[model samples]
Target: MPELLEVEYFRRLAERCAGRTILHIDVPDAHALADGRSPRSLRQAVVGRRIELARRHGKLLVLETDGPALGLRFGMTGGLVVDGELAIDRLLYSPGTFGTAWVRFGIRFDEGELLFHDPRRFGRVSLDPDESRMGPDAMAVTAAELGRALATRGPAPGPALKARLLDQSAIAGIGNLLGDEILWRASLAPSRPARSLAPAELRRLHRHLVATLADLLERGGSHTGDLMAERHLGGRCPKDGSPLERSTVGGRTTWWCPRHQH
Candidate 1:
C-alpha cells in the first residue's frame, strides 16, 4: 500500500504537471474512478484546465486544477509515473504482470504525460473535493500532536497499537507497512494497546516515526533493507536476523521482528 511517504513522493511528481494545461486525460479503465463517474466526465472536468497545485494527506494525493480537484488513493499498488520509457515500457509490455495492469488513467500535458499505474484495482480516483475525511499529514504532525491524537482511542481494550496507527483519524498515512516498521523501530509490539504505551515509549515511537519516515522519503518511498523488501521471500528481522513474524493486525498483514520488536 502507498504510505505517507509514497503519497508525498507522488505529490512531488505531480507538481511537475502544475502550471501546465491538461491537454488530455485518458481513463482507459472506469474502475480507476471510484466515484462511478464516466471517463468523459473526468475528461470534461480536467481537460484543458491547468494543474494549479498538488497536495497529499495521508495516502491520498489531490491535484488541484483550475477546474475540479482530482483525488487519488493508491490502494495497494498505485503510483504516478512520469514520461520515461522505462515506465512506459513497464506499463505497455508487462501489462497485468505483477498485479500491475495497464495505465488506469493518464494525463497528457503539452510536452509530457503523467500516468497512474495500478495492478490491483484497489486504487481510487475521484472528482470530489472533500479531503476533510483525512487527518493531518503524517510528516507534518509533531510528537505532542501524535501523542494527543493517539490518546483519543483510549487505553487497552480500545485499539491495538497497529490498529490505532492504521486509523487515519487517529494518525494519517500509516498503513500496515509503516505501522510494523514504526513499531519495530520503537521496539514496541504491534498488538500493544495504544494507550498502554509509556511516556518514554511514546517519545521513542515518535522519534522513530520521524526518523524512519525521513529515511524512507529519501529512498523515494521504496522499501529497502526492510521487511517489506523481503516479504515475498520470507522476510527476516533486519535488527537481529531473527525470523520475522507475520500476522493480521488492524485488518492488514503485519510483519515484525519477534526478537527485537518487543
Candidate 2:
C-alpha cells in the first residue's frame, strides 16, 4: 500500500507536471477509473486545463487544475512515472515495464507524459471534488489531535490498535506496514488496546510516528534498511539481534521485534 511518504513523493512529481497543459489522456484500463467517472468525462475535465498545483491528503494525491481537481489513489502497487522516469519508490521500479500491465492511465503533454502504473489494478483515478471523505493527513496531524481521534475510536478498545490505525476516517495515511513499524518503534504491541497507552506512551508513539515518517521520506519513501525491513524472510531484529515475530494484525501480515517491542 502507498503510505503517506509514498503519496507525498508522488505529490512532488505531480508538482513538476503542474502548469503543463494536458494535451491528451489515455485510459487504457477503465477499471482504474473511480466509480461514476468515465474516460470521456475525465478527459473532458482535464484535457485542456492547466494543472495549477498538486497536494496530498492522507494517501490521495490531488492535482488542482484550472477546472476540476484530480485525485489519485495508489492502491497496492500504484506509482507515477513522468518522462520515462519513476518518481516515487524509484528504487523499486525498473524501466522494463513502462507501458505494460503496470500502466493504467497516461497523460500526455507537448514536452513529456505522466503515467499512472498499477499492476494490481487496485489503484484509482477519481474526479470527485469533495475531499471530505478523507481525514487529516498523517504528517500534518498533531499528537494531541491524533490522541483524540484514537481515543474516540478506541473507546473501550481491546486489541484493535492496528485496526484503528488503518482506519482513514480516524487517522488517515497509515497502512498495515506503517502501523506495525510505528508500534514496534514505540514498543507498543499492536494487540494491545489503543486506549491502554499512558500519557507518556502516547507521547512516545507520536514521536516514533513522526520520526519514522521523516526517516522514510528522507530515504525516498521505501527504505529497505528500516528496523522491520525484510522480516518476512526470517530476518532478525535490527535492534536486539533476536528473531522477529510475525502475526496477523488488522487482517494484515505484521512483523515486529519481539525482544524489544512489548
TM-score per model over all chains: 0.84, 0.89
Q: Which residue pairs come into collision in candidate 1? A: 99-119, 100-119
Model 1, 27-54: lDDT tens digits are 8889988767898988888888888999
Q: lDDT of each prediction vs. the true structure? A: 0.77, 0.79
Candidate 2 backbone overlaps, count: 0
- In model 2, the worst 10-residue window by lDDT is 88-97
lDDT of 2 by residue, 92-210 (tens): 43333554667899999866988999877888999854677666788878889778766754236654677777878878898776787788778887877767678888889889888
In Å, residue 231's CA in model 1 sits off its true spot by 5.2
The prediction achieving the highest TM-score against the true structure is 2
Give the C-alpha miss distance for residue 212 in model 2, angstroms.
0.5
Least well predicted 10-residue stretch by lDDT in candidate 1: 85-94
